[model samples]
Target: MSNPADLGVSSLVLQTAEGGDINPVYLGIFVVYLLLVLAIGAWAYLETDDVNDFWVYGKRLGPWLATWSYVANFVSAVSVIGFIGAVYGDGYSIMTGIIFGLMLGVSGLYFVVHKVRELNHVTFPDIIAELTGTEVARPIAGFVLLANAWVYLIMQLVGAGLLVTVITGVPYEYMIWVIGGVFILYTVLGGLVSVAWTDLVQGTLMVATVAVALVYITLDLGGIVTINQQFAALDSGYVAPLGDGTYTGLAVLASIVAFFGTIFTSQATIIRINATDSIRTAKIHLAAAGVILAVFYTMLIMLGAGTTVALTDAGLTVDNVDMAFPVLITEYVPTTIGTVIIVAILSGILSTTDTRLHACGVTTARDIYDYFTGGEASDEKLMRVSRLSTIGFGIAATAIAVNPPGTIIGLYEWRAVLLTSALLIPVYVALYSRDTPGKAVLLSIILGTAFGPGWEAFGAPFGAPPTFMGVGMALIGLTIGHLVLKGQKETPAETAVGND
Candidate 1:
């Protein structure tokens, strides 16, 4: 391939009246893919008759579907776009977070899922409430879950906007609405059933696309050894274990802990676990997804490095590292192949977006609305509220996304670490300690939640992450609250409603 700037006019579409063109064929492929997604959403809507089906996919997922869905949900725009961009901008050391974070994080989830499924809960709040035996815990956890979802949703929309704008030559502000609307439509219509099934398809496509892209790029550049030699020739640091000193040892460690916290406790992921047909199935598929994600993330990080090397060789320059993958595909690959890569990027973005939407809806309907409304609302009415909440949340995310807060990785890390700190300890107590009181659980969440943001506001004392302080505060609060309320009668563990 020669300079992408020299590709024939017909191979690209006009980006603006005054300048470059985008490939129409690429846009055509994108349109077709979205239509297929809409069709799937319609099918899911017809299948969903109640809140459980909407929220948990009727708990009937097989191992393969579960595995793919889990991977898809885990590798969202954050992994493919944000983290990959960081790898390109930084280096190999950036990869440590996925390596350490996911290995430990997903391992913990294996234990957590069995307990989660045994609880037979529909949302994160249900898990906390069931164990703590407090109605107030439901809405409090719900609010935290909603806050997490809201920030996460904004992150997805921002990534989507970046992708669509770069690929289609449209402005990001216009692109976010289109992206948000599509997510809202599918999620509002069909809920988690729609999200899970579509994830299977999106996951497969993304993996296949990356595999093809990697193989092609490697072969085109001569081979792995040659690519490494070329990178060393450009800059020895490009191949260094700790690239450019951007990610210090402490930063990597904190990222690992934070990633672990996020994956194990994210409501979107918890719901994916709940969607499994059985606890055994959830464990098998989740573990498989972890291994698969580790591999995919490794490749994605390399892909970023590969893009940088290729661009350096081609004499191309990107203003932002986040733009590297998109620019690489559009400039270096054939239009048809580039189209597939574009869809792959969209697949990563949309997979996470839909699940976040479902999570917000479930939190709103089950945890906040229904719990506060005395739990007597009709299924039909609750389902209606769920649908409305999905749309509402989508709109809110889009509004916030119109002005992106920051880099996808930065914003995601800030919010995820906080949620993990606030939610993880309370959940651990609920699942394992039958003697802990609701008051203690509630106080722990409050203290943990407060400590995370407060520590960050205080400049992250000792260079320690909020996760350490937050979880530590939560444990301390838990012990004190338990000691203070030790004489209260213990609540019997509640039985889950359904079985495999």
Candidate 2:
């Protein structure tokens, strides 16, 4: 085990180590995890009866469980693959950006969670409609949320398909179809109940797996000091405060802005807060989730940095930087433990996919359908449409996953821009400021939406990233629109409506 030569593929092949073959162990752990997930789904289904139960667990979830579920939902394919890939490529600067960015997101909860809990809405679009006093806002918010959720879901499915192909030699196409189909079935069968419960379990396992892997990797590298020394020997930049020119000052600032703006407005994260039992619970959960996310992401960055040193020194080429963490685990850890890490990674992907799909379905039904139809739709009818929409969206995501349009990280960042621009201002005003006029709020959303896509198409000048530009335009529009509208004379009926 002390042999450095034993760490590479060539040496392992010569030793005829059982560690190389992951099929049986991977399949076994997956089966167990699947069974546990399905069982939880079934339990949740038995506990739920109405649409509220299906969508928000009847708003009865406790602090700890809700907190765990929220944290799990937030840490998606981005945490596992995107963050690790960034660390491997750019080093500690990426980690610094993420830590500060995440703290900004957590602070956003303080501004909005209590108000969101007060609304008592079952869906994100419902909150929008309530805030803006316009039916149109619901569908617009729904579209933005749907776009973000769909893109994120596809990213998770694609990651799962890739992981399966790498570990089991399955065709990527087949794995995509199989993984997507299973997720759709489980999600549609149990809805939010299934997603939440499964997330809780996956979240626990993932934390344990990452902690164990960190300890094991540290020991294998001859402890923390040796690991740091080795990293410095390779590239002192790895441990530096700022990245090695890979990410610029503007890019880092843009990242922080996007993180804060999106987390405050993103339907996926906000809806989790609304799903909790009470305002106190929501706040507690948000604080706890913040801490958990900070630790989990920091561990991932460290693992990525460590594995980069270990692999590079052994003359290995990490073609897919996203796989660096798993590759290191399998190469260095005992076979049984390695299997657990692989399953944990797969669990991360599946947890994210399941929650995203559920959000998409709920948004389509509640935000789009109920709004247009004047909330007259029967729960049965809406549920039927929701299930069908989930399948349709799942298929579309699978297609996109099969042929990704850009780097997964780029796709995610762009989606965040779109979401932040479109919904951030309106959502914040709705939660905190009662004076925000409905007309002004609607105008802000429209302007913000335009600004994001507009800046991207026009190539933002002043070296401003689209995320910053869009958010800036949104805030400006919001402030000016409200002032202009406030100066105008109000009709007697309009005055009455405002007072009400």
Candidate 3:
């Protein structure tokens, strides 16, 4: 087997084959890419004149740009590194959570597109507040967005630092600041305009590179049949539907809920829909992104399966499976092509990081700060606050990434739980349940978010996922509140219905 250090040392970066010097090629590539995005940021700044322009490009994005932006932002390095590694370790079963769940979730977004565009709100928190008809709904949803996004931002910074360090032999400490500071700078400058436009390029790069890589690797391994034969030869479980129980029914189901909930409830996804130039654009772009992701994730799975055969034949072994994608590239891919693939992976990481970081700033400025300030802050003041919040949130996430305590993966898992459990029912009922009081929805959000974490903390008794338990608690809260406050104040939905 190949060495554990084949990829890189502490940073998992690769050095020159001789003299162990840093690879100038990789370093040069990193610098050029950074400069390009920074340039885009500067241009996006001109387009950003007010809070509307900054947050959602004044709701002017068309289908192609919107589709690519959502795809690029959502895919992230998880597809590049984690998903491949997941398939490598657990076989196709991991797809139930990571790939299929995301696919279904995005497609399912269509069901609510009409309601989302009808409201035509600014932020996800704005939707929550508008739906709930409560002054505090904005801040409550803001907290959810901030908590999830901030931790996710930290994870991206952590992952990027580690990835760059491994690829270039740069010090982990230095990479964190450079990567974090650069993205934050651009995020502050460009906002969503910068993010959406740059993602068009990034998303295309991702698809083209992966498409080429998947084809080449599959042919190299003598096609899919040969690859499957090799998998079964290594371990029958590898070819099994369940992959030797690597993922249980409960686990797979949990993943579906978490992933589904994320797309269903998160500010990040909702912002994409709300930012479209028209409701039709929202529908077309979301559906397009989902289709692209379907093809993209399928390629990743095939690549993962192919790597299994390639590594074995090359006598390569990865100490950590997450390194499988990079390992395969270094060992099997040609230098020029492999270099582009690596950069594309990094691009995936940055695309998502910038989007989430942008969400953080928007949430804080609009949902938190503006709400407290009587919602009359001048466009000038809101713009200023939005930029400042972007910087503040980005820097904070970076600082935590520097000295993160324990495993950060837990933070990623908690995101969907909080977003979906806490807000899913509330948002839906607010949209559809005409007779349900706004206070009932409010109670649902509070109870669901509250007990969602409580169930998680209590160890998810009987193996039930905490997210579902939180949903149950939320339903209970809704019922109780509906019974008590049912006639006190009509819901926003009810008021709309009454007017109709």
Candidate 4:
């Protein structure tokens, strides 16, 4: 089955007229850029000492690199393609939901970063086991983290393939293989070091490219004055913050919850936090990410809105609204710089993909294999397992991307709903509370995991978001279980030893 992007989401007829032609000079630049990425990975591998270095890079990331890593990981291709498409196709109001959601995520991170760093574990599940005093929490947190990561990695791969195809006219199938291989190579080789440094490069380019686009595009359209006048000439609903009848009250509310869930429960974000050097550094990273996202999203929203006005004024109709940004780049921007923008966008997606792939390795080694095997693996043995796991997971994600289940944004939302429902409260309770019994946690995990999908299958009663229902069910289960069981006190066990 063709993926959603191939089937309909990116099938803008104008793509042929506008994006079919490719410049050899631009392709050459992109190829050189990719080659540089691989070279960096090889250098990172040379510095790798053990499994710890591979997983968390010795927890030595300072503020700037950490900030770039966090920003790059947070702003993936899904955010660009999925979000821009939604804004273009619908109304500008979706931007509000995303912006607030991101801010909420940053806020949650502020509260947890210090504790997370102190725990000093490579994967989230290791931290969970520390606080919950139950070995089972490892697999529970690990499985959900891995599952959510896989779904998201696949979404990124799908987005990467689509973006490559639109820009270079390469066959999507071929592009998928190339993209997947490149991601696995960097992640499997150098681990977090490779992912982090490359992110520094990728994140800078990503933001610069977007900032340039916003300025260049705005100037080309005459000015902010001209852009606003153009917007004013269009349908009022199109320019409004609320979408054009597509995003209802319930849908907007659900998006808000979903965004919060994504940030709060995101393994990718948490893993980045664990990689930072200190609590102070982690907060700096979070604060910087918030600032970067504010600028990035503002520019992106304006670009999407401007694209809509420009395309409509030209009397062109796009079959798939997701092609809005691509069409704008192809038709308007100068060829050389446009090629650079394409690389920047491609880098944004790759940055996220590589992070998740590295995360899969860390979680698989620390949480799943080490926990089940009594935690006795040698560092050499552990490093071997982690690299192998990264490769294995990368292949699995590629297979799923072959026939993606939904649009980029939809798949992202589904993953967020599951993560929030299954893992959010458990994670929070584990990190911050001591009174909640491990038994209660286990039961809450089961119910919260079941409730979200169950509600989706039967009915989402009272128009409550799946995340809302799942979180509520978890809170209630945790409370009742605590009362009935009078939870067992945790045994003092220092598991954060080597992790630090």
Q: Give candidate 2 regions above 4 Å deviation.
A: 1-22, 329-332, 457-462, 487-500
Using TM-score as the measure, what is the rank order of every candidate, best first?
Answer: 4, 3, 1, 2
Question: 1-500, model 2: which lDDT tens digit per residue?
Answer: 01111123222222221223447666666667667777776776677687777677778889888877887787777777666766676677766665577678787676667887877777777777666666677787788889889988987876676666556645566667878887887888778888888888888878778777778778777887887788777777777767665567777787777777768776767667778888999899988888888888778777777777777766666544555665665555577767767766876778889989998888999889876786689989888878889899998998777755544465666777888888777667755776677668778887888888678668666767888778778788888878887645434433311110
* lDDT by residue for model 1 (62-92), tens: 8999999888887777777776666566666
lDDT (C-alpha) at residue 78 in model 4:
71
Instruction: Give the Cα RMSD of candidate 4.
Output: 3.4
lDDT score, candidate 2: 0.73
Candidate 4 lDDT by residue in tens digits, 79-112 = 7777777666665776655667767778777877
The TM-score of predicted model 2 comes to: 0.90
- Report how far off residue 464 is in candidate 4 (Å): 3.3
Backbone clashes for every candidate come to 4, 0, 4, 1
lDDT of 1: 0.77
What are the models' TM-scores?
Answer: 0.91, 0.90, 0.91, 0.92
RMSD in Å for all candidates: 5.4, 6.0, 4.3, 3.4
Clashing pairs in 3: 11-166, 12-166, 13-166, 13-167
Compared with the true structure, all predictions reach lDDT values of: 0.77, 0.73, 0.77, 0.76
Candidate 2 vs candidate 3, lDDT winner: 3
lDDT for 171 in candidate 3 is 73
Worst 10 residues of 4 by lDDT: 1-10
Worst 10 residues of 2 by lDDT: 1-10
Give the local distance difference test score of model 3: 0.77
